[model samples]
Target: MKNMNQLITIAFFVLSTNFFAQDKQDQQNEIVAVWITADETKIEIYKEGNVYLGNPINSKGERNTKIEVLNLEYTNGKWVGKIYSKKRGKLLDVECLVEGDNLLLEVTTRFISTELEWNRAKS
Candidate 1:
């Protein structure tokens, strides 16, 4: 009876761990899609290995060309990363969250922090 109870406990622990890991993966994948900024710039967000990256697909300025605007990794139940600021001419700390059809990105710097919203592009 003791051995059987121990086996059941171990099995439950393993199953619960697997379930939570899978759930986190699903949450992380939700950000993988094309998002459009308020200025109508299209950014494609994709996963490369364990990290998520975003790049602009369509923009007129040379600054927006062939640059990784976003580099994110999931940690502590949030997506933490750095985003390239074209205006600031550098990369800044960014946190990303998906709320409904909007992707909220908070960019922080030494002096100020601001949030930008990007809408998920329709397929």
Candidate 2:
């Protein structure tokens, strides 16, 4: 009887650990949805084929803006995104974040500063 109790305890512990691990992975793999203020276009960004692709999520439009992501850096418990736009045929530098149901996108060029808020979508 004691051996059976020990085995059950071990099984519970292992299952709990796996559940937590999967939850963490789900959080990390979440996609950040964005809406560009320049043209009111909705874009969904996902890491696909080992690269980042931004597509019009709900509405379709002629969009030619995409920055290849090299790495994702986190700071102060916030998700920070960095991308290279020179290779994507754009002259914009972006550093943005996703917090709860809000996204703050910062774009800068030689002499332009654009900051916009992106409300998250309910899924």
Candidate 3:
């Protein structure tokens, strides 16, 4: 009886850990998809190695010639990275969150900050 109980306890611990790990993976993967910007631009977010990168897509669903606009990594329950600002001609600090069907990006500078929302693109 003692041996059987110990086996059951070990099995429960392993199963619970696996479930929690899978949940965390699902949350991290939620941001990996095509998202549409407020101004109607499409940005595709993909994982390259350990980091996530995003680039704009043209009208015909092709990647734009410009450099990647987003470079982010998941850390401590949030996505932290840099976003390239075409108007400002520099990379700015950014933090991202995925909420339901929307991905929210918060861009910050020394004296200013702004939030932008991007919706997940339909398949």
Name the lDDT of candidate 1.
Answer: 0.89
Question: How well is each residue in 1-119 modelled by candidate 3, as lDDT tens digits?
Answer: 99999999999999999999999988887899999999898999988888999999987998774779999999988899999998899999999999988999999998799999999
Model 1 misplaced stretches (Cα beyond 4 Å): 59-65
TM-score of 2: 0.53
What lDDT does the true structure give each of the candidates?
0.89, 0.56, 0.92
Tens-place lDDT digits, model 2, residues 1-123 = 999999999999999999998886566555444444335545566555444455554435444444333234433434455534534465465556666676676766667866766666555
The number of the candidate with the highest TM-score is 3
Per-prediction CA RMSD (Å)? 3.5, 5.3, 1.5
Task: Candidate 2: list runs displaced more than 4 Å.
Answer: 32-39, 49-77, 84-96, 105-116, 121-123
Q: Give per-model TM-scores.
A: 0.83, 0.53, 0.92
Candidate 1 TM-score, true structure as reference: 0.83
Residue pairs with clashing backbones, model 2: none
The candidate 2 region of ten consecutive residues with least summed lDDT is 67-76
Per-residue lDDT for 1-123 in model 1, tens only? 999999999999999999998998998899998899988988988899989988888545223446899999988767899999999899999999999899999889987999999999998
Q: How does candidate 3 score on lDDT?
A: 0.92
